[model samples]
Target chain A: MIDLVSDPWPLVYVGITLGVTALLAYVAKLLIWGMMRQSNPQITIAAQRLGVSIVWLVGGVVAVQELGVSIDVLLLVIGLLGVATIVALRQPLENFGAKYFADVYTPFKLGDTVRVGEHEGRVIEINAMSTVLLSKGDALVSLPNSAFLRQPVVNLTPQAWKEVVVPITLPGTMDLAAFENTMHRAIARMRVRLDRRYPPIFTVKSRTAQSTDLLLTVMVRRPEDRDPVLAEVNLRLTEAMEKAPASASRAASGASAVDPGH
Target chain B: MHSVDSRWGHDAGTAAEPREEDRDLFSDPEAATLATTAVPAEGRMNAVSVLINTQTPLLQFPRAPRGRHAMWEVESNFSRLVEGEDYRFSPGGVSRMVYPLARRMLTEGVWSDVHWVSLNSHGPEMVRLPGGITLHNVTIQPEHLGGYGKAKEAIWSTVHGLNSPRSSRDLFWTDDYGEYTYYNRVTAELIRELDLAHDFDLFYIHDFQQLPIGQMLGTIKPKLFRWHIPFDSRKIPAQWRPLISTYLNSYDVVVVSSERYRGALRRFGHRGPVRRMYPCIDPAEYKRAGPDDIGAVTTKFGIGPNDTVVLVVARMDPAKAQDRVIGAVARLLPRFPRLRLVLVGNGSFTSASSGLGIPKSRTWRRHLEETAASRGVHDRVVFTGHVSQSELESLYERCAFTVLPSVREGFGLVVVESWLYHKPTVVSVRAGIADLVTDGENGLLFDPDRPRALDRQMLRLLRDSGPLSRKLGEAGHQTARLCTLDAAVRDEVRLSGELGEN
Candidate 1:
């Protein structure tokens, strides 16, 4: 058997693979940290996990090459598997993507009366695959997420024009009280355009170990200002999430400092 | 007077005589219907989720900067506080009466989830109190603090019938009004968020400062508003009436402290379910002090053993009618030379720098001192300036009788305190407590507006050493039972259950 450890070419290949893998892992971690610091923790963690798995996959191939395995056939097999998986899970993936977009963009929410296509009823639920509505005639209408994109939906909720709902996802580790405080202070800056009677409200929708989902709702005084207000609110939401962890840590430290006994 | 008689005594057909315009105005069914339904069911228990709001928090800590503690972390219960040093229970009707009622409802499991949002500038963002109660604090900027103070003062003055109606219209349009609205808006927003989480059964809002919160909340949930101030329809400006009524109509039920206030609300055209609930205090909190305790308290205030202590336990404000007590004391000084007047309280949270930053207390106290000096009764007056509860009890025990001389008091809790101590009280006619007092029977009732009513009442109490004082004290104690927490808890639990049924 050849002493592969002594060979210069094999040693160089091993070093290159290990070095690149470590560098890639570090870079991926940094990106994840930045995203988690700036965006929703759920999104950041999801992206991070995906990035780490991809880096490990590529690193494994490099390591195999160092061990003198043929790479062409392996690449072909992986590509074929990827294509097959994509084709099989297309519908679920589409529905998931639609749900994500609907959370951010859809004006009508659960409990709101909405009209989409031939269906008109109070929106009872908004699930991953369909938006459920209870019709006036006691029939349940389940519309696909794709229909919301294709059809023109009219929200019949009184003062629906004034309502702006923003979806927020926070990491389980993030302190809710701190996040709420920062969000309140951030939204207060936009009080000029927002209706004084109806201030911004954040309602917790659901919670899991990975993330806590909340809906941020604000009412605008003028109909024309909705789009601008939505954009501004989104921008603030992004900023608040980014600033939250550090501010939360700072607040915690400040509290502890003020209360030494604690 | 004849018109009044004709309208009330005759039938609809007979009432319509000669005045065709009046008949036509009364004949419109739609207008009449609107008038009758204008107030709506303000008092109906609508089985709705509620949000209770007040300025003072239900729970307060003795120490400052209670940082980084969990919402449930309470180191010491209210009993641990040494009344004056560690913490002083917040004064005024809201803290004394309103909070206990809310707590009782929660304890009785009448309310689904009672969320109290308050202005605790010094406390945490949120405190999860006992019985699933959550306290939300609203913080205002220091710069806007002064403006907010001025705005609340204006509203207070207007509601108490002190400010002229002409000046009140401008109040809604001022920059201070914006800040005032900002505080209320933030509170409303908080309540809205909480409602989305807990889906509360109803919103029971208290105090005059939080009046706009009902309109701002915009929830279809049953809202019960309790106005804890003197509501005089005649005092409200004509231009301000529509706006005030708009806010009042937002509530399903509008509760006032007195029937007099209910009538005033009707005159102001608040056609809602206006109910009268007399403010109450927890009698369990008051204990009769021993003679030694009384001596210790009076000695601290430099009250000699021979001196007759006349106590007035009220915040240092012109509205409290402290000047009336001072004037009455000055008048009776020559006759009863040993009489020592001990004014108990200082400024409220609004007048404190750590709180709302209002200076009315300081100004009013200064005016009072000047009046005392000018009248040559400064030597006899003892401004104890915010005594502890124990000290207050001692003073109540040591004094001949107590007086609530407010020009317009919402309800007098001090008289109730005097009653709890089995001490006779001389109450101002303007106080809501006067409704409970039957002149010389339970407690003395005197018109605050009269120049010598308070003086004569003071003399009457001073000269009487016979069974009359003891008889009045016993009767006053009986009246005090009507305003105790035990009675209040029963009424509040019943009200909460009734609301849940609706």
Candidate 2:
């Protein structure tokens, strides 16, 4: 702590440096969010975290230097702490990292009857570290998320291959009806490649005061058309978001091709 | 001499005097029946708020004048407006059936707060009628309405067996379907907003146009759907089965117009309780006009005193099969020299300029006129489009018999109306009301598809006009009791109570 009775120049400089660091961190988050708006929401969020951390790290060193503290020692201490924490929490960190990748690549979701390796059951819950399933014998089985990446999983749902679920995060202040209408009009143009029997539908997953989570599902006419249809749908959805009012915070995740479970 | 009522948001003492006709419009019809009917006492229910939705609005307003904008954004009170000039009550099941049932239920305290939402593009955003019922209007963009109308009309035609299933099998994937979903989504969002404010206990959705609403609502509250159109499981396209079944299963209970439809719903894979409630009307809404009233309407239609009039009351639509009746009448003209056919009603809400603006009604009417002309009976056939309530009563009083020639009718309520007038009716075998008609007892049934079946049935009434007609008419009047407001109120109250318990 700086003594207030002495010269106040150093203290003012330290306060100014910290305040500017906070402003820069917010700007960095918005910039990263804008740059990766079309990418997976997880990657955008992670990038934002990295950008904020860098800004704070550099500004923190400059602020500490104004207080007559050495910056080298602090950097060395933080680097060692980060390394030790990663080593100690290796299992959980691995599971956590696997959860992110599995979320992007996994074909099965909750309520789906899936067979992973030697286990066959219905998915009941998916957490950060593990996936819970209920067996046919009414037994609950917990499997680490990392194991999903290592095993081959088979989805047993009928016509599950036709499902393409696109997750969207819309600002609460934005009009849901208008957005849905716009997206519907956009998706309708691609009906030639979609299943003629199952129209595109939007299902609300959850909502908060700040944002609403929605899943848009469209069925593909041919099994081979799933990948291209999803990519086109994501592109159209991104264009729709860009055209919307700037007041809305746009965040649409990568398409998750899975059984929507009707 | 004025009373203080806060419901109208006006000082009654200084308010404009309501017209005499307005008083007659607001007169409670249930009070006359409540004395004899077995309605539950007041406060039987827990005063739950209910939400009602339909595609047809309760009232149809006239178009705004040129260079003048209508104040549709403001809330309107029906009591302060004139009937014909300001707004006219829509003429269909909404006006003749749903409105009276809602008013009667409110009178009996079965429902406390009722909010009705409908698709009214030109009407006010909100309107307050008497008896605690509020109407909310939902409008879609003009550009989108065409696609929505096309999709709904296709479903209507498919269900009525007028079109091949293969023709519209891929309707769900068309861009028009997206517009249909847009309309439903907008309505659902508005309903959700209302639900958040009122905490509705139940949602009652009506007819096929709103079939997807139950699935879109995303509410925990119980939903009841009433299908007003003919439902034949075999007529539904295979491609529509999954979506239709999903929508049906979303509702807690599905109510159909007849037991036949209820069975068909079950066959369609609906995993929910189904109720068979007959389409009803208020007997009090009709009156037996005197000689002068009958003579005035007859002269207006150029009916001679010696002519024996046969009436067919249906909107101008192909499914109604007005041409079938015209052909039958042409054949009957040789046997009965004084035979005259009077076709009543013009169009439904869907065909109105203020509504979907579909030209089906106009095209069907022109086709009907051509058919009559080709049969060389244009001089004998009279098309009196959309008669008033009293005029319809006068026509009912003057007619010798009525015919329901629909190719496929959900439930022929016009037969019930004719029965109320104690007039003999020849109903089609395809109608749901045929189940209620015993052969040679209450009414006569004819297969519309059979070439001369309707002509033979009509000859039975024309040959022996005294005793046989009287016997059939008297027994038919008794059958009408099963489909009146009193009977409907009891079933509806029980349904509401059941939903409350669950």
Candidate 3:
């Protein structure tokens, strides 16, 4: 209508920017994976997600700029909108972010008894918004998940320190039995650092069409060995995953993710 | 009406009417469901769907089903295949007890449907039994099966108190243990797959071989585990306590064969609902063989008519202590010159050619033969590898007495079979059934760990002065009622009903 075919360079440049951004996002994902290969897989995954998101955000801004938009004004408006949203969802955003941190960093799990500040009860549920506790008198107590991060929480369960649960996420098509067998053999090699009485056990947390989530639990002999054992088990799990055969179609429906100890 | 025996203080005789306990066990709605093809009442819960996992397959196919016989290709009805020719019911507690129980429950509509999963390497993927029960056979590579068999055998040996030196306390750390886990995981995976379709109401797992399955299964559904073997806390290694307790606690209910085992489970730190259910066999499956049947069995085994046959029906394994019975027989040979010991049974599924193919049974048999020969009693002992059910019944009828001489024994169902024939038995003190025996009243008890204890007990039966043997037999026949299928069904019905409520 307005002689749009006269100069298609802006559209072409925008398309090119998006194409390069995709390639860069993939490269960033690989770099994150390689760099944090020896670290906890959760950290690696989070970093990879963060890296790709930043690449896309920058690429999107550049693509928009190629359409003759003012970058300074667009970014100012975007920043203000993001700030306003965060302010509006401050409580929920805090709780949601805290839940992610608590999942990886908290000492207690769903079944463990814990004391946070003046509150103490058996944890019955860990939901998106709040952690529910069943009191000894049969009363239900709901606490904000963000409280777990702010307060010094003490796990009251016996030998809670000995437990180290590592979370895992795998492709739905991975051979779970073979992966489990490989993990067992790998964990067995570190028996000296582990409590011989309790072997490594994997529990399925959830499953989906694309991925399975699992939690791998191991008991350490000494409290000091918890962090090291967690790191080493994560490393071993990654190695096992790398070597895992691509087919466990039988158990694909029961794939799972992992989390640290209760 | 059923007569209550004063000595036992329980109904020892069968009646045409359901017993009082049976009425209480199966409610009116359940009885109504069993009586006719009718649905349960409005308030009553529907019949439950059960997923049963056991180590023993219900039927053993000589080879894997293929082509037209493949499970996916057919309706999976196994009635067309002639049993014993195309397949055979596995010779153990599974076929003897579990199969009949499933059939009875199905007929009664106690269960809506049942899917039984077992490790049967050479069998079809699935087979539908007569009563609409689906059998899911789980197969693994032979090499993996070999490792799994070794680990299971080691656990068996440990639990039975065989105490082999090579049986390390750190068995969970071994590579063979990985294979054991692999098998359980595969079975659990299969069960999970089935649960998706059937949405089972309960999962009942049998024996120690599948103990880890309760923990491996992610479902929050009710799980019941039956520990079939001897479960002595002292016999279990200290290193195995935590893992064993963890696996055991994962179940909603844990059932053992004896009160002693229940106590032991408690002592072993199993903090769960523990119920003691005595292992049972269907008495209807056994028949009192006639004189002609006994004669045929005697002739086949070359046993003389004058011979005082002492029968021992158990698989040839070191734990069974068949050699101990041979030693006792050797000691009593001079006293009773015509004494012939008949050891009937070959190997368990683990030792079978189509199974894991472990040669423990064969090795144990050869050792037993050598032991008999060394004691100058080779010809006196008849080693009938394995016999048909009819042959076993005939031998039971022909025997003067049966002896269960084991270092450690689970509830000895063979002793119950011996009691069925009204044949006095000398049961090991370590057996779970020993709790039911009153020394001189129903059955004789012997400490297999003590030297000459079994011989002394056997001598008591051989040298019965008056009505000692007959009185013991009559009393034992009463005790046998406590271990029959009817009694088991009552207990099982109550247990499953309680599970439904919770």
Best candidate (score: lDDT): 3
**Candidate 1: where are CA atoms >4 Å away?**
A1-262, B1-50, B59-88
Model 1 lDDT tens row, B74-104: 2233223333343344665486566656655
CAPRI tier of model 3: acceptable
Between candidates 1 and 2, the one scoring higher on lDDT is 2
Q: Best candidate, TM-score-wise?
A: 3
Task: Categorize the docking of model 2.
Answer: incorrect
Give stretches of model 2 more than 4 Å off: A1-105, A116-135, A138-153, A244-262, B1-37, B41-43, B64-71
Weakest ten-residue segment in model 3 chain A by summed lDDT: A253-262
RMSD in order of candidates: 15.0, 7.0, 7.1
lDDT of 2 at B224: 96
Model 3 misplaced regions, further than 4 Å? A1-19, A60-81, A134-139, A247-262, B1-45, B65-75, B164-167
| Candidate number that wins on TM-score, 1 or 2 | 2
Residue-level lDDT tens digits of model 3 in A158-255: 99999887778888778777788889989999999999988888888887757778888889999999888887887887688779987543433232
lDDT of 2 by residue, A1-262 (tens): 5665687899899899999999999999989867766665545666888999999999989999998877788889999999999999999989999887776567777788888888889999989999998999999999999989888989897788888877777766666766777788788788889876777778776777588777788889899998888767766776666565532211111011110111
Mark the 10 consecutive residues where model 3 chain B has the least summed lDDT. Answer: B1-10
Ranking of candidates on lDDT, top first: 3, 2, 1
For all the models shown, what interface RMSD does each have?
10.1, 11.9, 9.1
